[model samples]
Target: MPTPKPSILIQLDSDPQPSVFDGVVAVDSGVEHLFRHGGVQPDAVRDLVYGALFTRGPADLQRTAIFVGGSNVAVGEAILKEVTKTFFANFRVSVLFDANGCNTTAAAAVLAALEGAGGVLNGVSTAVLAGTGPVGQRVARLFGRLGARVALGSRQLDRAQATVEMLGQVNGGRFTPFSTSDEDSLANGLAGVQVVVAAGAAGVTLLPEQVRRSLPDLKVAIDLNAVPPLGIEGISATDKGIDRGGVRAWGALGVGGTKMKIHKRALQELFTANDIVLDAEEILELGRTTLG
Candidate 1:
């Protein structure tokens, strides 16, 4: 009888508790022998990655993979860099960086917004509230890559600009920064926008129900906050494909199903190849395939 292929996944998380959400998804995606590490620092990634790299031979390396995640995308990114630095030639296992599920969540949210916008995203004027955040930054980046005129919003204009600059460095796409601290400012930032996505902090309302209802040009509205006083008010957590005032709206859970689907599909894609590194753009492409 042939020996069974090992399906081991090494999860390196920066949080104290290795994300229960990621763990559940990894298990559900058919990962066997998941080794989870919490409170992982960038400096410690070398040892952890080495552990995974050295244990399996090149041919058997497909059996092992790495997942970098945490609540903070910055730390997760630092860890991702360190993890990649440890890889040499064909001796590395496939690794995925989700960082609080930002990559998959943003991909799912973008996909939802495009669908809500009548299946058109190019040339659409879009605003990402709390655009300096991990998820918001990714959403803006993805939209910009898709040829959307993206406005990245933040409580402070400087921070938004910094995010826009950072995104430019990586993707060389155009992005506008706006301050959304007050109603007038947020309204101005969202003015003429066809798509509005609220990715603000938990339990904080970025766009009030009145504001969203009053928008004249808004065709799609999406909120990533599942907490009370959702990022975008007037949208229920369970709402999906609901039309309000001629605008399609999606709440957190509405987009969540898509996020979960993308997550699982990305994981399945990981196992298909030993050289795949599923990041934001790659994962977004996978999500787009699901749309068709």
Candidate 2:
């Protein structure tokens, strides 16, 4: 048999950070010949990606897959789309777009929501806080695709509407956007909702404890803010994947365990075939495989 094919992952970044280095480690779980380079400019990504493709041995290159990730989700997507047009059309290669672990992390969080809801996502009313952002958008999309009535919440009504439109395009109009800029609006958004996820910016509290406690119909509340001033109030940073109150609550760290698992598994999946594009739907399916 031929020597085991070498694998490589290219992390596209606007500004390099240490967190990216950790992300690389997770991606390298099943990959070989792990090489990293930064300072990727949108206008020049084609040649840069081409260089990585051709410089390595042609045989090893066949097993190679590209993973695009960065903090700037919109910019990262623009670059990845361009890269796809140039590289995928001309060459045979597998690639994935997972800016800020958006695909995998969102998949894990949604899986947690399903698990917290007794392994059923159909007909569930799930609320996604800060749903206009990258991760939040992916979570909303996944929830919509899984047959849940998704409430996409945002501080700006227009932004929420735009997000709902975008997600609906992918999910065939299954999500409804809600404005949660104030206490009353947030309370209204949470009304009759069974699942709540806070994917807002770091150091911001999107849902307060009283609101969480008042939701008698709530089944699970997951906070994806790993920073201080947790996204969902009353969720401790150290919370494990456990049940709390009448509703099961999960902090950022609580959901991270599954996120990391999905990330590593996504890397392994890149080598399963030469044509797989591990987007949100694929990532969510991978997360489901790991669920008990």
Candidate 3:
């Protein structure tokens, strides 16, 4: 038998320290050699990508891949764009962008919400709290793509509208902006919605226990905050599938296991082909396969 090709993953991070979460997942996904670079700016991507391209021939290029990650999705997206610019025909490596694990996390949360809402997302009204944030925006987009009538909520109405507009432009789905700065507004925004997801910042409570329990049409609620206070009140970090006030509820750790599985599966898929680019839609499809 010929010698086995080496499996190498180049991790490019925008932060000063590479993400420990991403590093651990890469190793768990069967990457034998991980080359990590921190504080990687968009300007420096070409040289770094060139290094990976030149070292491997076409047949073995599949063994190498790139992962772009950072705390900021915008910066990570820019880096991903620059990385793609360096690739040409027959000389490209598979790449994935998970900045702050937003893509996988969002995909998993949406999947969990759908599961809680009785396995169908089409025509279901859903509200995403903190919709201007990276994960919230992704969740909104994914839900809209699946035919859910998505209301992207933010503390600032302008921000929510901007995100809704952006998602509409890219995903061509039904998305509306809702101001959720206060309980009255949040209640109004969530009115008649079947699913509510709190993807807000750490330690901030987007939905109070009483408010969540009072939503008449709410069938499922998911909180993606693992920090203190939590995103959705009365939900613990480890809650997988629990019923609260007649609504199915899931906490951060509940959705986290699926996210981790999706991330690992996406990484493994990179080695199956040399041209796979696992972004939000591709990663979400991988998550869907896991459900079946």
Task: Provide the overall lDDT of each model, using Cα atoms, as 2-decimal numbers.
Answer: 0.89, 0.79, 0.92
Q: Give a tens-digit lDDT track for model 1, residues 95-182.
A: 8889989999999999998888877788999999999989999999999888889999999999999999998887676789999889
Candidate 3 Cα outliers beyond 4 Å, as residue runs: none
* Ten-residue region with minimum lDDT total, candidate 2: 14-23
TM-score of 3: 0.98
Steric collisions counted per model: 0, 0, 0
Candidate 3 has its poorest 10 consecutive residues by lDDT at 239-248
The residue-by-residue lDDT of candidate 2 on 1-292, one tens digit each, is: 8677557666666546524553555455866655554555578788867876677554555577777777677877887776776665436456677777788779988988887898888999999999999999999988888899999999998999998987777889888888998989989987999998899999999998888888899889899998989998888866765667767878888788888888888777776665667788988998889665
lDDT by residue for model 3 over 1-292, one digit each (tens)?
7796889999999999999989999999999999999999999999999999999789999999999999978999999999998999999999999999999999999889878877889999999999999999999989988889999899999999888889999888599899988999988888899999999999999999878877899989899999999999998898887987788889999999999999999999988877889888889999989767
TM-score of each: 0.96, 0.91, 0.98
* Model 2 error, position 140 (Å): 0.4
Which candidate ranks first by lDDT, i.e. highest? 3
